[model samples]
Target: MLMELIFNLGLLLIIVILLILLSWVWPPDSPWAPRWRTKKETARAAFKLARLGKKDTVYELGSGEAIALMVAASEFKAKGVGIEIEPFRFFLSKITVWRKGLNKEIKFVRGNFYKEDLSGATVLYLYLVPQTLNRLIPKFRKELKKGTRIVSYKYEISLPLEKEDKKNELRLYII
Candidate 1:
């Protein structure tokens, strides 16, 4: 019984250590939005909103699993780049994109997207929270070229809306 108790205590200690590490890397309630997986339907709506095409370049900030990037690359033939902060999500997305034979079409970078340059993007896709969107207002205004499309799911930006999909709860803006 003493040995079993010791084993359990060790296991608990390991779990606690892991939690601490994760919290340090990805703080809960961060200004950056939490991971929210984009559904296929919502991704499709975003694609349509952006009017994506083969020549278009789509950048997804905080792309959790790169689902939206996959859709854009596969269906629209657009070049897709995803910026993911968490290591697990970044690795997972890279593997998934490669497995889908979209290595040439899609790229995944593990880094803070706020620090990356977004000037090359023709369309920017986001599923981030409203707080994050609010914070990105200046970034969008500065980096995005004239008439660049911005598609967001479940949150609206203060910028003038070019289009809105009420059914899927998404908004599109032009810069």
Candidate 2:
């Protein structure tokens, strides 16, 4: 009994150590980076962009947990596509969308958002880092149609023709 207990404890300790290492190495690739919780003000701002019109299709980059996407689908009746890089978070987001019965209006894709096409989107929502946003702006300018709206939390693009509106922790850009 003593030998068995020691073996079980050692296995449990190994598992715990592995999990901790994975958590550090694979920390969710969310644009929010250090922060995972979505502030109410930021969510509201993203919702406002989605609520622009019923005909709008919104693409949320690095959509961790799909909170904003679910909200957009539920409240504005907008179609939402979310891209997430982390496997665990993407699975959690998928489960949430399924449980919420938003499968029809909201879809979550597990991959890098930078590689995905955003041309079909009428509105784009981002909570990514400045470097990511900088890399995406050129693509947005090239592919996004005129009048396309982008809502970003805590970052802005220095486009020559983009309009900026600051409210709370969010920024709105219209191309």
The digit string of per-residue lDDT tens for model 2 on 34-68 reads 24546655676666743555788889888888787
lDDT of 1 by residue, 22-84 (tens): 655563224222344788878988898778999999999988888999999999999999988
The TM-scores, one per candidate, come to 0.84, 0.78
Model 2 collision count: 0
Against the true structure, whose lDDT is highest? 1
Q: 46, model 2: CA deviation in Å? A: 2.9
lDDT of each: 0.86, 0.75
* Best TM-score among the predictions, by candidate number: 1
